[model samples]
Target: MNERDLKKLKSKKKGKERRAAQKAERARLAAAQLLVNQANAQTDPLSKFPSFINYERNGLTSSLICKKVKELEPELLQWAMNLCKENMRPLYEKSNQGWHEDEKVEEMTEDAAWYLIVLDKAANKPLAFSHFRFDMDYGDEVLYCYELQLEESCRRKGLGRFMMQVLELMAFSNQMQKVVLTVFKHNPDGMNFFKKCRYDIDETSPVDSYEETFDYCILSKMNKMKPTQKTSL
Candidate 1:
């Protein structure tokens, strides 16, 4: 073929390849959306994992239950809120955002929010709780852990790690892309805890700039069983 004809052919082939890639991406994201929707519809994501319901080690015995915000009793919700404030208010007040009780309550009571609550079996009182949601983040389906607060008495025990493992199991079993959370930079203990659990700074986490630095960072643990393509930096 002549030079001009060859150039035209090459352009046409490139255009076709680009369109094909775009179509494939759309299909992939559609599948992700479907997975998230299915997960959100479940009344109890934890029900399927019977073994994870009970924590009976590290000298701390507790039972876990997962429920949507609407399903939670008023008193239980109040306790969770109180525990969150007890564990995090100081850290929140110290952060750039400061502590906003109203905003936090609103978020905790959102219709889509879910709670994985841990109760002390003997006393029948809550020891820890994690508020989370299955949603899309940065174009990927993720299990976003909003809060993982434990009562002071439960700290330093292995309950925190066990709860994290449960969250990971639920996230991956339901086909979520990953388990994501935000941790304050000032809370070294919190940051170190997640790091020990194998979480790393996610791609979407904000970076410090010369003008303004962030006080918090986003961390995530990707599902090794269902790997996704990562964009090159």
Candidate 2:
């Protein structure tokens, strides 16, 4: 081959080598970035997860749960009891004097169930409450929900909506098919709130004042929530 042709061939080979080196370096950098991203994801699933909280709607549900766990530890019971006692009777009376058991004899109300909702972690008070557990047939297993007690102090501040959302997530995480709750027909504002949440009446009561008849509502969600705290890689 001519000297000129040989020189051209050497130049071409050098260019190809440089191109190959650049391509390999780019691949290495990309792979490194991918590893970093994957590692971060493994450590913090919350970045890709939904923030959810689990809470019971009523105060009585917690009492039952606490009672069952009474043998576990005293600290839990003390904290739970405080939350229940503080919000239990007064809150119930706020709803209606007869809506709940007399505070004095409430301990005897073993039949009453309680649910709890912990408000924002930063809030001065944690959302803890209780409710009765009704066996409403969701066409399959009986559904349970907190019949939230509307408090006089905290009422009308949009807490009901917040509590319901928290309860829904808890129910979903527990494999509950749906959540069922009741509002007195006289509670128009309460009924409106449930309607806004798209709750529908599933059953009506037989009619009594305290345990009175009201349109029962069933609010169903996809049960698709996976709390961020419990998420895994």
Candidate 3:
């Protein structure tokens, strides 16, 4: 074949391959989304915790509820600890601490240590958990989130965003002025995720304090409330 014809044939082949790859990627994503939805549909009702909020996204369903860390079952608390170790090991290591070995279960069970757990009903498993409490921050009542960790398998799904949305709703329902959380500076992805969710650096953060030298970013999102309405809680 002439050089011109040969070149045209090669270009056509490349175009076909590129299209095939794109098609396969789309198919893979669609399948993943389907599995998530099926899992969500299988969630069981939380009759014990009538106040639990049920949310559905990407065909997956998760239940968000609050409980004192002490109230959690031993196995569930252990699951949470394992998740924290998996997600925060790098941050802890950066600060020269052995977080994995320090179970800290007693500290986690403090009266003020509350947990927000997202359970996958169909699989009867916890998909993610957040440790938080209502505390006075700069003279304002804010929900302070200590840890928000998801199972490794659940990371890329919309579960993080879904959990945060539920948390914010809970904050508003409880008359919290804002929701606040701290992210390690070493975890740029965590920082970026909070920012994308509309959380901004809190002016009250001790970013420049001399005594507190840990590399952390404190983020806050103000709650929207009606002037005349008050939360029953």
Best by TM-score: 1
Clashing pairs in 1: none
lDDT of 2 at 159: 60
| Clash count, candidate 1 | 0
How close to the true structure is residue 109 of candidate 2, measured as C-alpha lDDT? 36
Alpha-carbon RMSD to native, per candidate: 1.8, 19.8, 20.3
Q: Give the best candidate by lDDT.
A: 1
lDDT of model 3 at position 87? 76
Residue 66 lDDT, candidate 2, scale 0-100: 21
Residue-by-residue lDDT tens digits, candidate 1, 166-206:
99999999999999999999999999999999999999999
Per-model TM-score versus the true fold: 0.94, 0.42, 0.67
Scored against the true structure, residue 121 in model 1 reaches a CA lDDT of 95
Q: Sort the predicted structures by TM-score, highest score first.
A: 1, 3, 2
- 149-218: candidate 2 lDDT, tens digit per residue: 4434555555667656655644443444456765555456767878887777544323446765434334
What is the lDDT of every predicted structure here?
0.92, 0.45, 0.70
